[model samples]
Target chain A: MSLDKHAMAELIANDIPRGAYVNLGIGQPTLVADHLPADSGVVLHTENGMLNMGPAATGDQIDPDLMNAGKIPVTELPGSSYFHHADSFAMMRGGHLDVCVLGAFQVSAAGDLANWHTGEPEAIPAVGGAMDLAIGAKSVFVMMTLFAKDGSAKLVEKCSYPLTGVGCVDRVYTDHATFLITPDGVVVRETFGISFDELAARVPVKLLAPAR
Target chain B: MSATICDSAAEAVAGIEDGSTILVGGFGMAGMPVELVDALIEQGAKDLTVVSNNAGNGDTGLAALLAKGRVRKMVCSFPRQSDSWVFDGLYRAGKIELDLVPQGNLAERMRAAGAGIGAFFCPTGAGTSLAEGKEVREIDGRTYVLEYPIRGDVALIGAHVSDRMGNLVYRKTARNFGPVMATAAKLVIAQVSEVVDTGRLDPEAIVTPSIYVDRVVAV
Candidate 1:
């Protein structure tokens, strides 16, 4: 069966290596945090300026001053630390982060990412931490619907919109399939509901089978 | 010399000139110094270029100041948020200009200003629209774009507590830009929840050293 958002998140959660320092991008990519196992030893980093950030705070746990990058009130876990924005970005840019899950508007075959601005004259572009997160993390995993509302593929030969980072994505996790973007080509690691041929047909780019 | 303790927020923000590039600290409304921003609004400085994380949330603080048509430009990371209708309205009407930097660059650029760094190569915006027209270089097999320091004329910040000498400590993530912005500006004005005697604050635990701070007002 085709994966829903939760299934996609669960898949991504299960794949994260143990003790990974992870940053979950805003929106759908954040769902990966919920599916992470309790004893996984993974630490969450929020760009707004906290590490070991806990789940959404409710009731008494909510502190006006403590929030995630999305500006949502959040709880902090034990060993959680606060830092200024410079140090926070330094953690990512210095190659200290292991993995960062991002939501992409489009990811090209060469792994070029375009998720920040759509380039629409009417759209007020906001590029928060996506660019730094893209090139910083050792691995950049993208989460997005495989197709646009107009029924076009999100994975394409080249990104048409304003790019966030160049050749930065490692893997793209979508509802229909999980694809590994490699120097060799776009490899279909696994498909959920559609056949390999159907998936290939839907996407404009050529695809490769898993090397193994 | 230590910072002067102000009796009110308005007194702290006095003498800010028009067309000043002010660094207002906050990520959304968390560490936002609402009182100081209100005072800036009351102080009636116009043609301002503000640098912050977000433009504003709802119709308060920065948004209120923007609504007053005092700000001419916003140099920030993210300006479009769910509650950012005020910035949207003015921006749509061409009333305010925007200079969008990535969040990391927004912080580090100001940090460069504070630390006396001239310019640095960063890999963040390399090969993006933002990097276009900027100088690019290859260092150790990776491409980097040149970025300059972002200094501010005045810094308005928020903190949880401060000592009489203006050694400041902040609560949780509220410390986002306060520490860095404090150093990046000529005059720093901090609005704190409480101010105690100079020796009361543990010097070891102080987030922002008093040397960078110029004025402290207990909000």
Candidate 2:
């Protein structure tokens, strides 16, 4: 059975090392914040100038002015601090973040990432902090479906969409399976429901078995 | 001393001529200077350039200005929110120009302008299409793209409270770009909910000092 979004989030959460300084990209990646273990010691950073941000706020706890880069209301942890936007970007671009989880439209076998724009003329260009996070984070994890709704594979030989970062993706967590992009190739770390042979048949690229 | 409180929004935005660039502070509508934007609309200055995080929302504020065709160009990060129809329509028709900077780059460029830095190298967009035509350098085995500073002729900002001395405090997330914009502009006008006496505010709570603010209008 393919994992649902919540299940996929839980899977991603399990891999997060303790005491990580993480930045969650806008959509699906943001869900990872809620599933993190309470004692994970993860410090969440929002590009819009907040650090140590807690989970999403609900009801009266929602403060209109306290929001994530995605414009969703969020709570601040006890040691949370706010800084100028430039300083915040400095933290991101200066290799200070331990890991950043991003939502991807496409990831290449070589670990290239393309998440920002589809390059459609009519589409509004909204590149929030994807580029910085993609290149700056020590480790980059992509959270997305393995295939598009149209049944097209998102893991391709090369990215058709404009790239967010070149060869920056380290791991990909999909509903069907988890894959790691290594210097050798895209390796199947784990699969949810499908047999290894079936998954290999479905995937467009060659998949290596997990290293013993 | 005393703050330079303007009697009206029009007076606060006075001298904003055509073709001028204005830095507008806010992230959506939260800390937006609505009254100041309204005053700019009423002033009807044409061929203007606006710098902000988003293009605009819905049919009001910055959107209203765009709808009126007062804006010649917009330099922003995210220009395509669901509510940004005004910008979308105009951009599609080739009537308005867009400079889509990365969110962090936009902030840092403004900060660089304020801090008197000419240009700086950043690793954010170094290898992407956004780095096209820009200078790229290798520093200590990492690639960085050169980005220049962005400054404005005037800035419209919002604040929760201001003392007559022009010391300002923002309300929560609404303070997004106000402090940085204030420093990057030649003239800074703030729209505030209330203005207290000069010494009424605790100095520690002030985010933007009077030095950067030129005028204040209580909305």
Candidate 3:
């Protein structure tokens, strides 16, 4: 069976190196924080201006002034520090972040990312920090299903949607399997419930099979 | 020169000319200067350009200002949110112009403006529509797009406390753009929960020095 969102998040959380400064994008990526071990030493970076972000705040702990990038109230950990927007993004674009996990609409064989906009004429576009994380993080990971709701492959040879960053994605974790983007091309790292051949057939890009 | 202690929000926000580019500080409602914005609306500054993180939420604060057709353009990174209906309506109806910039660039541009930088080449938006037609050059073997500063005629900021010197301190994430915006504008106005006597607030703890602030209003 394919991995559920929880399982996928856990897999990503377990792979993170200890003491890695990570920024998990909003939505499904935010759940990765849940599976991180208590002593993982992982520092969470919120684009809205926080570091060492803690779990969700409740009751007396909740402060309107302290929230995650997703605008949800969050607590501050022991090493937490607050800065202004410029300093916050400098941590991103200045090569200070070790990893950033993002959600995507499509990822290309060349590791281009497209998630911010669908290119719809009437749709309101909101890019946020997607492009910064895409280009800045030392290693950029993506967590999303292999296919869209229309049953189309999201791992395409070329992105049909507008791109967030060009040649930026490092690893892609999908329900079917985990794929690693390399200078050569996209390669299968491991399979979940699907076979390498079947995954290759389903994805439009000619994926490099894993070395057994 | 020292910052003047204003008696009211309207007084702090006064003298902002029409069609001015204003920097409104906040990451949503967290650090929004609602009192100053309310005053700006009442002060009737139209054809304005607003730079902030999110456009507006619900029907209060910045949204209310936008609803009155006071904004001519919005220079922001993200404008679409669940309750950003006011900005959405104006954008869809072509009542306002939207300059969608990457969040990092949004901050850096303003930082550049305040720092007196000519312009800087950035890697964040390279090879994307946001960098389209802009000057792209290879620096240190990596592609970079030239981005310019985003200055403001006035900056409206919200902080937790302010002393008579106009030195300010903010609370947690509420400090998002306040300190930076304070420097990037010609005039900086801050609305604080309360005011204190000079030298009462520890100078070392002040996030924004009095040099960058023009007015301090206690709401």
Chain A superposition TM-score per model: 0.98, 0.96, 0.98
Cα RMSD for candidates in order: 0.7, 1.9, 0.8
Error (Å) of candidate 3 at residue A41 is: 0.8
Q: Per DockQ, what order, best first?
A: 1, 3, 2
* DockQ, model 1, C-alpha based: 0.92
Best by lDDT: 1
Cα lDDT tens digits, model 2, A127-190, are 8778878988899999999999898889988999999999899999999899999999999999
Please tell me what DockQ candidate 3 reaches: 0.90
For each candidate, give the interface RMSD after superposing the true interface residues on Cα.
0.6, 1.5, 0.7
Error of 1 at B35 (Å): 0.2
What are the runs in model 2 whose C-alpha is more than 4 Å off?
B1-3
Candidate 3, residues A64-98, lDDT tens digits: the string is 99998888999998999999999999998999999
What tens digits encode model 1's per-residue C-alpha lDDT throughout A78-141? 9899999999999999999999999998999999999999999999989999999999999999
Query: What digit string (tens of lDDT, one per residue) describes model 3 on residues B115-140?
Result: 99999999988988888899999998
DockQ of each: 0.92, 0.68, 0.90
